[model samples]
Target: IIGCSIAFNLAKLGAKNVVLLEKEKMTGMGSTAKCSGGIRQQFISPANILLSIESIKIFKNWQDEFPYPVQYALDFRQAGYLFLLHSKSQIENFQKQMALQKKLGVVTVGFVNTHEISTALPYLNISGIVAGVFCASDGVADPASCCAEYEKQAKMMGVQFLTDVKVSDIGANGTTRRKIEVVFTNKGSMLTPCVINAAGPHAAQIGKMLNIEIPIICHRHQTIATPPIKWMKKNDPFVIDYDDYAGQEFYFRPEAGNENTGYQLLLGGHEDGKIQIADPDKYKEKIDQDFILYLADRAMNRFKEGENIQILTKSGIAGLYESTPDALPILGKTEEVEGFILANGFSGHGFMHSPIIGKIIAEIALSGRSSFDITGLGLDNFKTNTRPPAEKAIV
Candidate 1:
């Protein structure tokens, strides 16, 4: 979505001959299609909070700005996100984090006590819950629909998309690195001044084609859905029970409708550890039912209402989290490669931050630098001598 959005914005700005290349037979067939589609501005870092705020604005008014329909109305309910806290120490920590978030101009985040949480979510069995944080602007959307819309809008704006054409290699020219030439499968070759690595799981490998070592790894996440239940509402926000013993193991929310059509649940188990894979094609897609049961057990312990829910479907996908040394993204340019730009490592927040990233990358590609200052996300931050602190609100 970020790549297509950037391409669309570039073409809209009168940049002629803009082309997009995809390795698959269709666009958004990769990890993008498997995202949970959660958009939240309740982050601990200032940069991420700002980016999410700006992206939410674009998502809210996409139809007004773009001529074509982006199919964004996949039940964007702002019922508010609730993060549970079981321990007193965790509650204090959340209070500090909420304070930082509020100081950074995040108006929707606030600390809520146990009584407030019980009153807000009557269905939840908050036996051990003490306090929590709520962010009204944090919500969910349909990932597949959003990605398709971006591609559709980009196509309408005269951007040529070449599917099933894998980028074989990229060749750079000039002694001081002035231009880049990309070689793809069916399209033959094309010379451009810039290239953006939005390849998701294969981003690090794409950087390796130019001998640049990007610190990113692939992680597998599983999601399940339940059969229709009467108590669940369609407009309920994405819920996170932070008090799980497994450490942020699960998240649940309504699918799209309110006629008791069931709810969708996403689980990231503690036992389902991340595995390092060099090739994207070698990923495993089959989900472990045992892991799902483990996560479901943890979730049911918190929300007793879930124990009787019937699971309708369960599936897994291989998506790259693209973790940095500090779990943040490496955006901007690298000193080792001249024309090579870095935009990979999003840690799992790529979808939520796609709009801001697209705009910033477009500005950098067209005008040689981003209007928004990205010095904190520079590639040199991972050079061992100067590493940035890890942002604490990644869950």
Candidate 2:
């Protein structure tokens, strides 16, 4: 999705000869397809918040940008995001985060006490929840559809796409110290002055071609979809049980609606405090039995209706998240290579941040810098040991 968005934004910026390559047989078969599709501005970092704000501008009014009669629809729903706070420390931390968000012009987000939460979502148990930070503007959308539209518009603007093509190596002109001259692929080689590495999980492998070490690791994230619940509403806000009581932190949101079967619910998040590093080529594509049991227990504890519904183990899907140490995407041009740019290590927010990342990458490629300040998102932060605090507001 980030690659397609970058191509689209490049074409939109009047750049000619833009080409997008995908390793998969079709686009969006990677993390974009497996994502939870939650878009939010309730982040601890300013860069992440700004990215969400800018991307939400397009997501909120996708039709204004894509127009109607198009093949793809985002299926966007602004049902909001509610982060349940349990501990006093959690409440205080969120209070600080809310203040930061308000300072950053995220005025629509506010704190909702337990009473308000219970009033709004009576289905919740609310046994230990003290408060919640709700952002009505932050919601869910169809990532696959959005990526498809981006590809379509980019193609309309003369951006070429090559699917099922694998990049083997990157070659630099011998005369220059660090300048990419050709991209070697399985099909053939293409001469290009610049290359943007948006290669999600395999980004680090791609960086090695130019001797640029990209610090990213792939973690397997599993999600389960429950059978249609009769009481489930189509407009329920995405709920996050942020407290880690008994080492269980879970979240749920109404899945795509169905008239015949009612509404299905997508449930995920039961951190076991172990990083399950995954090989991009080989990893379990199904949820673990233990995790499934954990989610079932979480569901029963959080909601009154959870006991009646059965958790479908077969309905689970898993994917990889390319995460960095700081939980922020590495963007902008690199000093090690003149024409090489970094758009990798989005953690798990790639789909949500695609729009703004595309624009920022285009700005850097066309000009020298972006209008939005990405000073803190550069790879240099790691080299200087000045990386910002890791994001704590992540689900």
**Cα lDDT computed for each candidate against the true fold:** 0.71, 0.87
Instruction: Please list the Cα RMSD from the true structure of every candidate, rounded to 1 decimal place.
Output: 2.4, 1.6
lDDT per residue, candidate 2, 1-395, as tens digits?
99999898899889999999888898999888889999999999988898999999988777666523457868888899999988888888888988998899888899899999998988889998888989988889889999999999889989999999999999976555678899999999999999999999889999999888999999888899888887678888989899765465799999876766668899998576844899888988888887888788889989878788787778898898899988998988887788899999999899999988988999999997998888878887789876777776666
Q: The CA-based lDDT of model 1 is what? A: 0.71
Q: What stretches of model 1 exceed 4 Å from their correct place? A: 69-74, 176-178, 244-248, 260-262, 266-269, 272-279, 316-318, 384-387
Worst 10 residues of 2 by lDDT: 61-70
**TM agreement with the true structure for every prediction:** 0.92, 0.96
Candidate 2 error regions (>4 Å): 66-69, 174-176, 245-247, 259-261
